[model samples]
Target: MLMPIAALLLTYLVTLALAGLAAFVLRRPLWVLLSELCGTEERSSFWTVWSMVMMIALPLLFVSWARVETDPTELLQGTVAATLTGILMAMGGMGLAVWLRVPRADSL
Candidate 1:
């Protein structure tokens, strides 16, 4: 019913928030990785943080999707779908970070 839907949305939001926190913590490492991968000297701190956040949030989103399902089959499907969605989102975020010219600031 609506309860399951609400629960799923809530879980997604919670996961997103957690990812944001993770991104904040792992921004530097993410930036370094991205910089090396792209073979660019330019640094986009904001994008790195955002991408890392998305990556961290992805697994939580899959867990939430699985939790909201009633049937085991549906849950499995949801988990797979959620995982793919998370991967796409993370990749998109990383691509955006690399394409955007956001300035990098010194980390504390």
Candidate 2:
């Protein structure tokens, strides 16, 4: 019913918020590491893309490591789907943010 939908919506919102917050906090460090790995000091699309990708991947890795104590149910499946969707959405938003942050040649 509506209750189940509401629960799923809540789960999605919570997941999106937490993942986005984590991405926001870790963006700078991630960019630095990526820039070093790529051996580039200047801003480039490559670093921003990889940083956003890692922002999504790292959280997913953590989630994959977590063990669920309860048995699988339809609701649980729905929740899982919602969570994944939210994570992807958050990553998409992060991609947009980073794209904006990166300097363009035309702007320089």
Candidate 3:
């Protein structure tokens, strides 16, 4: 139990750092897209990177929630219901990440 917990923790932290690095490097496309969406004369690098990180983080959290996470454990346990719910949650998280990445009208 202790070993697995340590390993999971290590894995989560390492992967999160990698994901953040990847998001930072790939920030240009998001900057372009967001700039277009906001109709801004200049790209907002702060918001762009922030959105990218959030987009990556959301799904990662959902994945960690399932096993070691029992709600997701059922899916791992091969239950059909769990599988459907897991897929739905993943999609919802993805959508939310994208939604959150988008600045609201008021923000613009």
Ordered from best to worst TM-score, the candidate numbers read 3, 2, 1
Candidate order by lDDT, decreasing, is 1, 2, 3
Candidate 3 accuracy as lDDT = 0.54
User: Candidate 2 has what TM-score?
Assistant: 0.44
Please tell me which predicted candidate would have the highest TM-score against the true structure.
3
Clashing pairs in 1: none
**Residue-wise lDDT of candidate 3 within 33-94, one digit each (tens)?**
66766677354666675566564565456546645422334333433333334444544654
Error of 2 at 19 (Å): 0.7
Error in Å for residue 52 of model 1:
3.2
Candidate lDDT (C-alpha), each? 0.61, 0.57, 0.54
Clashing pairs in 2: none
RMSD of 1: 8.9
Count of clashing residue pairs in every prediction: 0, 0, 3
Tens digit of lDDT per residue, candidate 1, span 1-108?
A: 345666566556655665555556667777786776556655445556556656877667566546676454564466556765676677676668555644457532
Distance from true position, residue 11, model 3, in Å? 2.4
